[model samples]
Target: MSSEETLKRLALETLEQDADRIVQLIRVQMDNLTMPQCPVYEEVLDTQMFGLSKEIHFAVRLGLIDREHGRSILADLEKQVSDVHEAYYEHREQLKKANK
Candidate 1:
């Protein structure tokens, strides 16, 4: 493939990897029973997401990735994060009932 194609492929891979890392971080927090409402948790998620969006914008501006694809990546990440949050709450509710 051409160098430009290679660069685009690398950019997409990097963005996906970054998104996966964020998901992993959320899983770890859930596993550790960390409170999702904690300010630190909010800050971390906000910062990581903002950084990823900037990277996506930069790639799109450089013609390294399609605009729609970048938007889809962010949307998918948001869905995954939401799923994790919901799972955490469900787990907490289960624990409460079990303890009673």
Candidate 2:
């Protein structure tokens, strides 16, 4: 493929790979996030995930990536974010009940 096509392909692949790593991070954090009342990890994860989604949007707008791939990246990250948020809440509730 031409240079432009090669760039686009590489960009899409990088996006998917990075997003997958972030999801894995979320899963690992969820597995051990039950430490003493600490919000740092959750806050950082949310911020990082949001920033990545925004980067995907900007990459598409700048013509670095195609719209379809951009949408897919955002959608995948959004779903993972939702799942992580739900798990965090459930764990928080469990902790509260335990403490009570």
Candidate 3:
């Protein structure tokens, strides 16, 4: 496979792994009844997304992926993250209803 192909594959694999991690995080927060405004929860989200984005840029600088490809990769991951957030908010609402 070409370097481009290799890079793409790696990016996908990494993204899948990270997405799973994010899901696990969301699950744990829900289990603990944590809110989005929780500082620790916010920190984790910021750290995870920021770290992944920086990694993508580093890969671009190394020529493993082009700028556009990097953006696409990050976009896919961001969408997954967004989905997790939606689930979290839904879970939070359910918790609120249960409490009331």
Candidate 4:
């Protein structure tokens, strides 16, 4: 395949993998936090947030996603990540609850 096509495929795969990992991590954190005493929960939460930010930064550096395009396409995804994190303290919340 052409380089553009390869890059596009790589970009899509990277985003998909990141999204899945983030959601899974969020779910685990939410599940663990259902109990009253989880000391490491906050740390795990912070790590996931940092991971998402890092993924965005990587995408920017690789030029796979332009800022303007990301603003339009990924804005909602980023917001969902933030919102899911905010709702992490809630027992019934799921990362899947965020926009897909």
- Of the candidates shown, which would achieve the greatest lDDT relative to the real structure? 1
Candidate 4, 1-100: lDDT as tens digits? 9998798678767776766676677666655654323557666656765676677667768888766654543555556656765676552454446734
Give a tens-digit lDDT track for model 1, residues 34-53: 98899999999999999999
TM-score of every model?
A: 0.97, 0.67, 0.68, 0.56
RMSD of each: 0.7, 3.9, 2.8, 7.5
Model 4 TM-score on a 0 to 1 scale: 0.56
Error of 4 at 44 (Å): 1.3
Q: Residue 1 lDDT in model 2?
A: 84
In model 2, which runs have C-alpha deviations exceeding 4 angstroms? 35-38, 84-100
Ranking of all predicted structures according to TM-score, beginning with the best and ending with the worst: 1, 3, 2, 4
- Pairing residues by index, what is the TM-score of model 3? 0.68
**Full-model lDDT, candidate 3:** 0.75
Q: Which pairs of residues collide in model 1?
A: none
Instruction: For residues 1-100, write the lDDT of model 2, one tens digit per residue.
Output: 8998888788788888878888887777678765423588768677777878887887788799878878878787879867876878888899899999
Best by TM-score: 1
Query: Which is superior by lDDT, 1 or 3?
Result: 1
Instruction: Select the stronger candidate by TM-score from 1 and 4.
Output: 1
Please give the lDDT score at residue 23 for candidate 1: 96
**lDDT tens digits by residue: candidate 3, 1-100:** 9877887778657755765676677767766768777898889888987877787787778766678877876677668767767887887788799999
- By lDDT, highest first, what's the ranking? 1, 2, 3, 4
